[model samples]
Target chain A: MKNWLSPRSTAGIVLIAAALVALPFVLATGGQAWVRIANFAILYVFLALGLNIVVGFAGLLDLGYIAFYAVGAYAWALLASPHFGIHWPVWAILPLGAGLACIAGVLLGSPTLKLRGDYLAIVTLGFGEIVRIFMNNLNAPVNITNGPQGITLIDPVSIAGFRFSGSSEILGVTLSGPQKYYFLLVALAILVIIVNLRLQHSRIGRAWQAIREDEIAAKAVGIDTRNLKLLAFAMGASFGGIAGGIFAAMQGFVSPESFSLIESIMILAMVVLGGMGHIPGVILGAVLLSILPEALRYGVAPVQKLLFGQILVDPESLRMLIFGLALVLVMRFKPAGLWPSPERKRELQPEKAGG
Target chain B: MAETLLAATAVAKHFGGVKALRDVSLTIRSGEVYGLIGPNGAGKTTFFNCLTGLYVPDGGGFEFAGAPLVADAPQQAAARGIARTFQNIRLFGNMTALENVMVGRHVRTRAGVIGAMLQTAATRAEEAAIRQKAIDLLHYVRIEDRADDLARNLSYGDQRRLEIARALATEPKLLCLDEPAAGMNATETEALRDLIDGIRRDGTTVLLIEHDVKLVMGLCDRVAVLDYGALVIEDVPAVVQKDPRVIEAYLGA
Candidate 1:
């Protein structure tokens, strides 16, 4: 406790806070595109934290987590978009979307309760694809989801007539649309992080970790493993739902393409790469994985042009290749993760010696 | 004589063609350290598992604390005030010694996800009480110094003690120890005998399943011996030891 409040640590915290506050302004100089990427990165942080509750804490391997995100996005699209000719407020839609996604989570979690490990992963993977396919085909019978073309003209998030899409002057500094959304995303992310931290130390958290360690022992200790596992799924899905609501408002669109199998894998990669069961590591993983690909997308063409003096391999494919290589290298070297939790580090210590 | 705390009438179980337990009727009175002993494959563990809800008996049932006990799951058994430690020491390895015990308090604690996230005044107080109780249990097992250590890192004897502490956290009416001294050294086994005595003296009924005849004879007030999944004799320890059937089962025909 004393070391936590030391001058050096306090100074480091203040420095990080200042940097977070100034990040968008500095990126604004590079243009609003970078600010938009930052917003998406924060969105990814929400998804990663949500997934961590299942995969990291409870040790349930879910491969279809993005289905919940899609649920939230479509919920917003149907009720708050011009396509439906309805415009509900943010407060009403956010919770509704979250509730719907929670129900979906429970529906998916029930049958899979008896499944574990790779089998659970396979079931969740099928669930994710099922959602995507439903979103794609639901257009014909009900004209819902707008099919492959997607829904447009979705209303932006607003509080008391103050629109996030519209720029406003604050302290004589004009804030752009993306800048405004960035602050909103940061505030929501902080709230989510607080919830995660609280849950991590609570009795419920301990039960989840117990089940993860040994399910039979946990049950023997009187933990209702089935209900608790369902709670994990519902809670994690609600986070995805909230993030999905914000995402729909930010992008002003809803498309099945945005919530793909690849997106679920990418969000999962964030949780695993950031260090499973560690909050700070997960946030870091999400931010880096979200931003790094964009950075490569922008830098690869120019670097190729400079090095070869001619156009080389496609920049998009090269960006993915580099991303894949980075992931492989990280996993091969730091199997537990780059910033693993202390408990996880201890779990691996003996294995390291034996291997 | 004390009232009956646990009564098993004609409890029978079988696996495939092998009969694991056959009409094993037993009565355990309150506030007594009862011992269940048998040779290998004599259905000691099978009967223990049936009583704890790990396995469903083929016939008959159990009455615990004057109520018919029908537990289909281990959690159900625990909720009915029956706590147990495993033969293989199944502690939550990644959790701290204190946390392992706190998990035992799960059925007693009522904090849900919302209360945990909100950290309401009542929830915070309950959490503190739980932590303090877990710490006290660790102290009871004489491992207060290792309260924060991971369960997996504890010594062999400490792991067994930790499992006992974890079971005690459930505040059970009947504590079932499945081969508690299985892998312990002589000194550790002696300490365990004293702990079991203390637990029974404190008014919690103990049901011990052990292979160590000496420990069982010394600690148990009444003993039941099983041979070929059938009860040979159940009486006071001295009387059971003098029984010819018990000698034949353990020695030879």
Candidate 2:
């Protein structure tokens, strides 16, 4: 506790909080697009943190994690959109989406409990594809999901009568839809971070790490490895669910294209690149990965034109090439990650530690 | 005579065509160091795994503390007051030495996901107690100074000791150690002997599997020798050591 509340850390916390609160306005000065990107970045933060629970903490490679996100988004779309002629409150729907995603998580996890490494990854990959396909095709039979056209006019998150979709002036400052969504996402991310921190330091966290280190050893020590693994899946999926719900409300839409395999892989890359099992590192990874592409999208074309008088490659293609190169270089140099957990750093580089 | 603590009846296990153990039985009384010794492929470790629920024996059952012990899983075996250390030193390598032991207390502690996430007062107290107890177990194994070190970074002998410390953290009625001194030097083996002696004196029955005949002959109150998955002999160490069948099994008659 004393270590946690040190003056330096307290000051750091206050500074970060101030920056987070001011970020939207700062981005809005540049352009509203930046704030939108920031909102997505926060959403990615939720996905990365949630995946970290499964892949980082429990050592379970989950490649179909975005399925839970799909589940949550569809839950919101079905409950609050005109497609179903049903409208549920944000609070009511978010929990339901999270609950449904958790059940989906358990369903996906139970069959793959006996697998490890590549096998588990393959199974999860299949699960993610299955969910996306279900969403894509479910429309044909019952007019559900709108068949890739997506459900529109979804209700924005509202409390009492104040809608997030509309601008509101508070304390001489006006908050736009994206800005309001940004605050909501940040608040939720903070809550998720707190939950991750608590779980990391508690018995459940220790058990997960133990299982990650050696499942047989963990079982020998009296840990119910099967149940704990399922718990990891459920917990991680619920976070993804919550993020998906918020994403649906923010976008006012839902589509199968939005929950693709690439998205799951990208979220996984964020967890791995930022630092698996480390909260700050994961958040950093999420923000960087989510924002970097947009930054490249906007910056690449102009910079190419200025330097070479013409673009050598399309900005979109160039952005991806640079992104791939950066990932490769980071992996080659860092091996563990950009901000690896101390234990993982030591585990991956035993020779340097003289162990 | 002390009360019987564990009894194995006609335990049998086979893998395809290879018969690992066949109809081997043994009894261990409370408060004694029991040793199991045999030649290579004699099924000593197999028997240990079967008892500890790492493997399900095709035939046989165990009576622990006068109850039918059906441990289909390792956690069930642990919850039934049986704890064990692996022959290959399977400590949670990335975790701190103390944390490795705290994990052993998982069966004893009652905090679930909600309790942990909430950090209820009782959960906090239990967590603290678990930590203190783990530290104590490390001290008992003389690795208290290495409590904060990652289990993987410790010296080989210290890692073995840490495994012992972790097993002891379960507060088991019976503790089993498989080849604990496998890679130890002479001095380390002597220290391990003292640690096992200390554990037995602390009122936990010990079941040890060892290849070190001298150590087994010296430390065990009673020893059992297995030859080709059959019981060669079971008696006081002095008697078993002199038995011709045991000699034949070891030197090949």
Candidate 3:
């Protein structure tokens, strides 16, 4: 049964495809709220996949990943919103946002490429906070981001005169805004998955993993480590940018508050909890974490009422406690993660064969 | 009479007040097993580092294959067909034996990000060729059966041989082996000697550093002795073995 759902199997592919196709319809019956949760989950999947490239493949911990996301969102918001009065199309603005975010990635990566581990993490954390604070305080200098008010009425995604902002009927199937965004996210997520898969098997991918394992050995074997590290950051940030642009267009709102240190940590947690360097594992981690809080928010109060005839603990606090416990337990028992990559699984083997 | 593959002239390096290598020079002829023997702190590894571009000499330079070696980085040195193994084994422990060798073939392969992403027919063919070459290298090192095994899982002698196989994958014209048989038993050491001979027999110049005096004397076509970071003598094995300075250097250290 487990093997049937394993990503390597044909049955698993079919099952996932069938489920993805049916999910929107299933949630549509219950209204847009569940679909919105799924949309956010998909967004987290995008963020996790992007973070996976840096933290997973390249073994570079980037705690400022949300900065790129923020850059991408701001780029989209400014270009396609009433705040700037530009109102560009989604296609035109998407690449620009991604490109700008990529530049930010390179800017951060180039200087910090020499730094590793906790030092790099601390620098990136600072970069993320700096970007947020800059965005927050930019209202006075040039009225760039409108200070803390954030951009509103951002333009929605439109493809070939078909706006995803409103309900649209396709083959007698009516799709709501959340449903439409869910499909788009799934499509983008699939594309990202393909990119991730291709990279994981490529020479560049091998070089990245080799750098992760041993940078000195990698350089000794002629891997141009400096450029490759930049590429990793750029590539990883590009995904974050795409996700950010989509997020801005979907919500029709952009804010510095949205891209916070917590967002970065959550994304990093998704990568770790899923299985660093494992694509499906990362996706699962993102999906699980994204849904877990919402599920707790809706389910915990009712469950508490039933168990004790009154609420003993607030859902928010309970939600965090459960999340923290889950993380700790997972780290303790399954250190490689829920779905570890083959190499990582070998690394975390119960008793490694005696040398 | 043979063409000189590597010629180091008056190479010098110093760490602060201490001279790690002072005026050390040697000429390695094409297709010869050259041995460099020295006691601890004799600067043999330092000279090896200088030749391999891991360390830039404070003064002087070396030429390889009739061109002045401009190896500011190890990659540049590798591009010039000079490959060396570490005194301690440095195989990528996480990777399989086959994958480790493929990394060594990285300089030889030229699939960029686009080609890799697109997985074009050319890239696919190249990747296959690389895998094939890597497998052949494993077979060459007599560890073909353990190709899929993690490098760290390999026995000590196998790991040493794997390092050699990896170095060979670079298709180097000059292979510098730093204490390749350091941790091996007598049988393993004998096997390693044969493998090193086989490597030189395959038309590659070999430069070796070893503490095993008998292995140095028996295997090296020519031997160079260093004392206090300076070359004491460069002669045939018999001549180097009997040198008073070499004897004194070994005993003193």
Against the true structure, whose TM-score is highest? 2
Model 1: per-residue Cα lDDT over B50-114, one tens digit each: 98888999998999999988856888889998999998889998888999999999999899888
DockQ score of each predicted structure, in the order shown:
0.60, 0.68, 0.64
Q: By how many angstroms RMSD does model 1 differ from the true structure?
A: 2.0
Query: Chain A TM-scores, one per candidate?
Result: 0.96, 0.97, 0.96
Is 1 or 2 the stronger prediction by DockQ?
Answer: 2
Model 2 ranges with Cα > 4 A deviation: A351-355, B251-253
Ranking by lDDT: 1, 2, 3
| Inter-residue clash pairs, candidate 3 | none
TM-score of each: 0.96, 0.98, 0.96
Q: How well is candidate 2 docked (DockQ)?
A: 0.68
Ranking by DockQ: 2, 3, 1
Kindly list the per-residue Cα lDDT of model 3 for residues A94-163, writing each as its tens digit: 9998999999999999999889999999999999999999999999858999978899999889988888
True contacts kept of 1: 0.74
**What is chain B's TM-score across the candidates, in the order shown?**
0.98, 0.98, 0.98
lDDT of each: 0.91, 0.91, 0.90
Tens digit of lDDT per residue, candidate 2, span B66-116?
Answer: 997875688988998999999888989889899999998999998887887
Give candidate 3's TM-score.
0.96
The residue-level lDDT of candidate 1 at A302 comes to: 85
